[model samples]
Target chain A: MANKLFDIIKSDLAELETALHESVVSPVATITEIGNHLIKAGGKRLRPAMFFLAARCSENFDLKRVMPLAVALELIHMASLVHDDVLDSAATRRGEATANAKWGNQLAILAGDYLFAKAFVLVTENGYGERVNNQLSRLLADLSAGELIQNKEIYKASCDTEEYYERIAMKTANFLAISCQLGAHVMGLPEKDVQALYDYGYSVGMAFQLTDDLLDLTGDSKTIGKPAGNDILQGIITLPAIRALETSPDKDELLSIVTNRDMTKEDLNRALEIVRATDGIDFTKNKVEEYLDRARNVLPESIPEDVRAAYMMAADFIAGREF
Target chain B: MANKLFDIIKSDLAELETALHESVVSPVATITEIGNHLIKAGGKRLRPAMFFLAARCSENFDLKRVMPLAVALELIHMASLVHDDVLDSAATRRGEATANAKWGNQLAILAGDYLFAKAFVLVTENGYGERVNNQLSRLLADLSAGELIQNKEIYKASCDTEEYYERIAMKTANFLAISCQLGAHVMGLPEKDVQALYDYGYSVGMAFQLTDDLLDLTGDSKTIGKPAGNDILQGIITLPAIRALETSPDKDELLSIVTNRDMTKEDLNRALEIVRATDGIDFTKNKVEEYLDRARNVLPESIPEDVRAAYMMAADFIAGREF
Candidate 1:
């Protein structure tokens, strides 16, 4: 099913890849180098895919017009990640050295900023006016706020589930929702269709994050491209761990292990064990499935059958994928 | 002369102050706190002043329409400064504790991103579309590139004079030039007037930075709001030091002292003395006057006499201001 969608959009995706590289080209050598490094250590391009898919759902979809918005969406995601890596003091991302690790925190900060500015330039140059600007700027703000909130909650034993949800909603769901909405918006689609796409993206985005956090503990470094328990090790308290903290019989021991700044390999393994021993992992998986169901239900009936089918397959792929 | 310009723009400046405070208001507590702190630290507001002055030069100066742009210009300046504080690991700015000093580098980084986002939001919300976005985004890219080049040159003995000019051009001159250009552009001024303001701004901005670098060596800490010789101590090779490196008989000695990361207070004093003994300070002062002259020469003849007089005073004031 995923392959069907991939095949349909294969050409668009290829063009996006080239645009992504071309967008970051700069007179500053360091910006281009660092930007190229990040583009090379690629993600799933989920935001751009969401955008392209949403755009395709409309009769007004002009590939030339939509291309800049698509590029901006993914660049925004990449810019946020580059900044996140600095905040995380992360040495590697996607099995490659991070910009910060390669060029130091200072240059990495500038590189992220350069990417952000380039994103804005591309959209503005293409004349995606106030709507795109307002949405993208607000998304950037919310993303930063998510990082701040996550930073504030790091290693706090009493980190609330509500807070965790809010953080993920800001960091992931709204970003994807906007990607979908903006695509529909730029196509001059009906407001109803745009809203529906936003809803679909929001649900899928929430599920995507939940699945991601779950995999951080359940998957191996070889598959995930980072060590297992990586997020928790960095003091991030995600849903499964929060659920474990609430429901585990060894709750106090688990809390102690997670909260310890000096938490070790043994401690992480044990914490993972304690979390797995609870219904935390099950609760998280169930939550993912529930969100994915919501996503499937929210699809606009006005979209063509093939696009609808592709979206359905995309959601299912998200639900079942190991990485 | 500065007071005359200030008096003319007093009400607009006050409104801008209120709007600036209002813009950074965020759901995230850290953003507001850091933003307010930076605002209260009290910069000269030169960028916004330049913007307002340029607006007033035109017949179409509508305060209501221009307010957002004014606020955005200053916010962008503040945003760049905040990020620069992180890069420099600065303890204080404008005689107050820096965001990074009070919070941490991580929070400071987020705070800077928040401010940058808020700047874009303001302009976009007010419906300043592609023209504003294109200019502002390019300015941002240039600013980050300036920081990158400056960072790359730190402690490098072979840093070129041409590179120093390019760095400062990117950092300060281009920012000021844009402030003037955007003001005229938004006011629907003729292209000739816009070009004139941009040229005027570019010249003054170059002089402003040269004077600033000069003050780093020649002014007292109390007046300058930072320790004398702070730039050199941080491995920044500015105009005066670059001049001294080329012309001073003690060139080799000064080069060694500036290049040594571990250089102490006595070393800085000695380097300052060597620079002073040469004609470096005199040479920089001459350059400042030359640029200020060019600034005065380029003022549009079509502006009101009062507006032209105010700009003339602005140039002289920038040439002579102690801080």
Candidate 2:
């Protein structure tokens, strides 16, 4: 079923890749170099794919009109990652040197700014209505605000599960929700249908982030691209860490290890062991399942079966991916 | 004359200050803190002022409709400053500690992003037309690319005088030009009048930057709020320095001092003295007068005399300011 869905959107994805390349071309060579570096070190292109799929569910989707928007969404995602690397002082992304690592932070900063401005340029030139443009701006606000909150919460052992969920919802889920909503919006779908699609995307996004948090603890370094357990090392307290702090008998020691800025290899290993010993991993997995279920349940009965099936497979992919 | 123009726009400037404060309020307290820090530091508010003045030049100008856009233009300027501080590792701006210096770089980056997003929110919510929004985005692209080019040209003795003008046009003049263009556009002015306003704004903007470059070389630290001659210390090759390099008998020595990056105060003083001895300051001043003359020449005779006088006063202010 996943393969079948991929078959349907394969050419659209190819065109999107081309559009992405063309969008980042700049007169400045460093801007081009840094932008192309990140673009070549790719992600799933999940947001744009979801946009295309949601448009497919509509009765009168226009590929040409929607293409620029799809590219814009991906560019926003890529721009954030470039900035995120600088903020995290991350040396590697997708097992490749980050733009900041290759170029200095100065050029990286400008490149990120360039990509962001370029994304808006695409949206404005393509004539997405005021509503979509406004929504995109609001989405950026939420994303940045969420990151600010996360930065404040770093290494604080007192962070709660609710705070964790809210942060992820802002940082990750909102973009997905808006992506699906925009897809439906471009199709001129009814407001009710658009709302349903947004809800579906939100739930799927939540599940995807929860799964990502779980992977940070349990996944292999080679597969995850960067080092595993890097989040805790960087003082990013994910759900698994939060749950372990709540339920583990070794809570104090684990907290000490996670909160310390200079945790060694042994300390990280012990922290992971404590999380594994507790119900943290299972608790997170169960939460992902719950969200995925909610996502599937929210779909309108009016959607075509094939379209519905593709969405379900997407949810499954999010729930089941190892890297 | 400048004071009279300020008197006419006093209430509008007050409203703009309030709007600027309101636009950056975020859900996160830190984001608000950092944003308010920059806003309260008080730039000249030149972009927004130009926007308002250009709008006033129109016959059917609507204050209520143009206010949001004026605010948006100012927000974009403030946002760029926040990021620019990060790139330059600037400790102070407008005589206050910079956002990056006050908060860490991570939060500063997010704050800048928040302001950029909020600027768009204003434009989007106010229902600015596609042309305005597209132009704003393109302006951002130019701004970033110009900064990138400037970054590349730093410390390079071969950079020509024409290149210096082009760089500043991208970095400063274009934003001012667009601010004016947007003002006329909101008034529903004819295209010819809009073009004239843009040209006027561009020339005035060029003069404004030229004066700034001259001030960096000659102004006192007490007035400029940053140490004089700091640009050359940081390897920024401004117009006066370029002119001095072209005409000074001590060209090789000045080049060595500018490119060294670790020049002592004695070396800096020697370089400044050499530039003062050459035609650089006078040459730059003549260029400013030339641009200001061009700006005055381009004004349509159809414009009201009061409006033309205010714009001419603006040009004089840019050319004559000490800091």
Q: Pick the candidate with the highest TM-score.
A: 2
Under CAPRI classification, how is model 2 graded?
medium
Query: Candidate 2's residue-wise lDDT over A1-323, tens digit each?
Result: 22555666777888888888888787777777777788888888889988888888877868898999999899989988888999999888888899889987877777788888898999988888999989898888888889889887788765588888889999989999999999988988788888999999999999998988889999987777666887888889998889889888999999999889889999999998998899889989999999999999998788767778888889988888898
Candidate 2 local Cα displacement, residue A303, angstroms = 3.0
Worst 10 residues of 2 chain A by lDDT: A1-10
lDDT of each: 0.87, 0.85
Looking at model 1, the pairs that clash are: none
| B294 Cα displacement, candidate 1 (Å) | 1.0
Off by over 4 Å in 1: A1-5, B1-5
Poorest 10 consecutive residues of model 2 chain B by lDDT? Answer: B1-10
Return the TM-score for each candidate structure.
0.96, 0.96
- For all the predictions, what are the DockQ values? 0.77, 0.78
Task: Score candidate 1 by lDDT.
Answer: 0.87
